[model samples]
Target: MRDTTADGAADTTADETADRAGLRGDCENCFGLCCVALPFARSADFAIDKPAGKACPNLGEDHRCGIHARLRQKGFTGCTVYDCFGAGQKVSQLTFGGRDRRTASREDARRMTDVFPVVRQLHELLWYLTEALTLPAARPIHGDLGRALETTEALTRLDPDDLAALDVPAHRQNVNVLLLKTSELARAGIGGRKKERRGADLMGARLKGADLRGANLRGAYLIAADLTGADLRGADLIGADLRDTDLTDADLTDALFLTQPQLNAARGSTGTRLPESVTRPVHWTPRL
Candidate 1:
């Protein structure tokens, strides 16, 4: 049997599982978009220089990376960690239906590039929503997550021209409302004084600046949720899905089992601080 279980992201670690589900880079089916569409500077993360919208210098004519297998040794770990969340396959097979970008008209190519970001953003949201539904605690937000997920999915199915015209940021602004609601439900699961948050579906809640010190937050669905400025000192964070969850400005000085990537992803406000072993994630606004 295939286990016949609901091992969606909320229940399982969407980090590892989603990566293995053929969601990561499989360039054979792609046009090397990440290599070209994304910009890279000469740094420890990237060995050679590459500009946005230009093909990578190492990109092979056959739409492959010259050093595909040795990307890590060549300092492309960021490239390796990136997951299109199924967008690469969708764009390759459906959006353009395996049409080669090389033959595309210059204007069409630019339009295609424009739409790639839109689809990419939508797929990322899919990954999060799919992961959220796996939580037994998040059942309360199931209706909201389902509706928003469908909306996001519909956007992903748009054709190149339609996708190019999409205002993804504005759509994100609207979806963030539901995501924020989902976050509140999920974070509420982190056992608090009220006790109603216990076993709550908090897969991706935004608990920024919330007080959760000494709270029982075990087995919470915390994958990728933002916890900026949240007080979590001595909070029971064991078994919580912390993958990619942002803790920026959050105080976790004595938090238990708050893993590296999870702790690293967090953005701490003035009130939010962490233990010495943990480091801040790459993304965050520390102006506060």
Candidate 2:
């Protein structure tokens, strides 16, 4: 999301710029992999149940969402918040050499489907590692993060069979170590007693206007919580569930590890102050 340092200044380093570009989804170059590879059940998110490896009814012949512009309005809110982290295009153009799934053999298509999720996971790690490298406070472990980013990027370029057989969870476990260190280093400079709410269940809690500066909210269940106007500056938010969380006017400047999908899933307002890495959610109400 952000290619800036912890101080909110943009990092224009060549590596940083390239990483930022590759980390975002470019649907035009993708072959609708997510619409077919992933399955969804009918819920508040989707209007129909779709099995894995089966194309969604809304997938077009040209490999685009038929209702791309109105996914949330059409009861496919899940799609709007779903980000493949640029895995879709990488799989379509590089892994399979731009082969169209419809025209490919059944076995090839199956392999494509099976390999997608693995690469997606790796790409997400790349995203985090890239962000970590940009943090000035995490300079102590920049070498480790750089190596991890290189290794993870190499893995993404592996053959489909190799990608499918890769031990992704093991790799993710290793990457988490560096990310944890980065979080600690970045939050250390924040002036205040930071709250430690890691993995805490704060679902639906009335925390409006709470002073949570430098809080470690990693993996915290914040679903439906009223966090309006909360001071979450410099807080670690990796793995925090923000679904339906009210972030209206919340100041999340310098928040660590907050992803776009997490922000998109929450309810915010135009008055919400966010980090440079993430944009204001289009669905957020405009301030009067």
Candidate 3:
């Protein structure tokens, strides 16, 4: 629920306040955890290969990105797309008590680094759960979503050892079931039956200008696919691989479970319609 203002500042909107959301990254309150804890190989998205626990050269002592203004220009496009869902600050301030890995004891540092990714997964689930609760079509399962949200929230507060020991994949599978149900209910409200493409391997498929209203695209491999001008209103895109997907002029006004990361990895034009939850990536222009 954290959106960028016209000036690119993380501003809280009225909807965010109404939901009491904590899903936006608050870098000011974090210890630059992602810059150091996450690993990256030299790829189209990253400039260099960095192992886990190694700090990026552009990370400043103040825990701010030194190349924030030119990340894409400097071949660090992945950094711009990454969102910790407020996990960085929660792990920094609450779990580690503001102690950064740089200055902490070796054991604490290792644990902090390990616990970050675990907490991040929980926070991501919280983001989805919070969104699910907002859908009126999912009203029948609102109680379950609220309980899942509470459980995920509590998991994020666990000690580093407990968090690191968690079977996250198992938890994710359980949450996915509920999310799939939510998707069904939401799309059902869109009227006619939807295309059943859930878990389909549609990599590089040509789907330009297709009528995909109420489609089930969960876990679809849409990498490098042409989705230009597609009518994706009310489609379920959770876990969809959207890397390099062309979304130019596509209508995703009411797309379900679409995240900022997915949009960041895709190409879009000024004509692309998006939901209120996410901001269009800066590089998405007509020329792309």
Best by TM-score: 2
lDDT of 3 at 197: 94
Candidate with maximal lDDT: 2
Writing each residue's lDDT as its tens digit, candidate 3 over 43-78 gives 999999999988898999999999999999999999
User: How accurate locally is residue 275 in candidate 1, as Cα lDDT from 0 to 100?
Assistant: 57
lDDT of 1 by residue, 151-247 (tens): 7888888888889888888987787666555555555555556322445568678777788866666567776687766788756564466655666
Runs in model 1 lying further than 4 Å from the true structure: 1-24, 192-288
Q: Could you tell me every candidate's TM-score relative to the true structure?
A: 0.60, 0.94, 0.91
Sorting all predicted structures by lDDT, with the top scorer first, yields 2, 3, 1
Clashing pairs in 2: 2-277
lDDT of 2 by residue, 13-68 (tens): 64666666877888999999999999899999899999989999999898889998
Q: Tell me the lDDT of model 2 at 72.
A: 88
Local distance difference test, per candidate?
Answer: 0.63, 0.89, 0.86
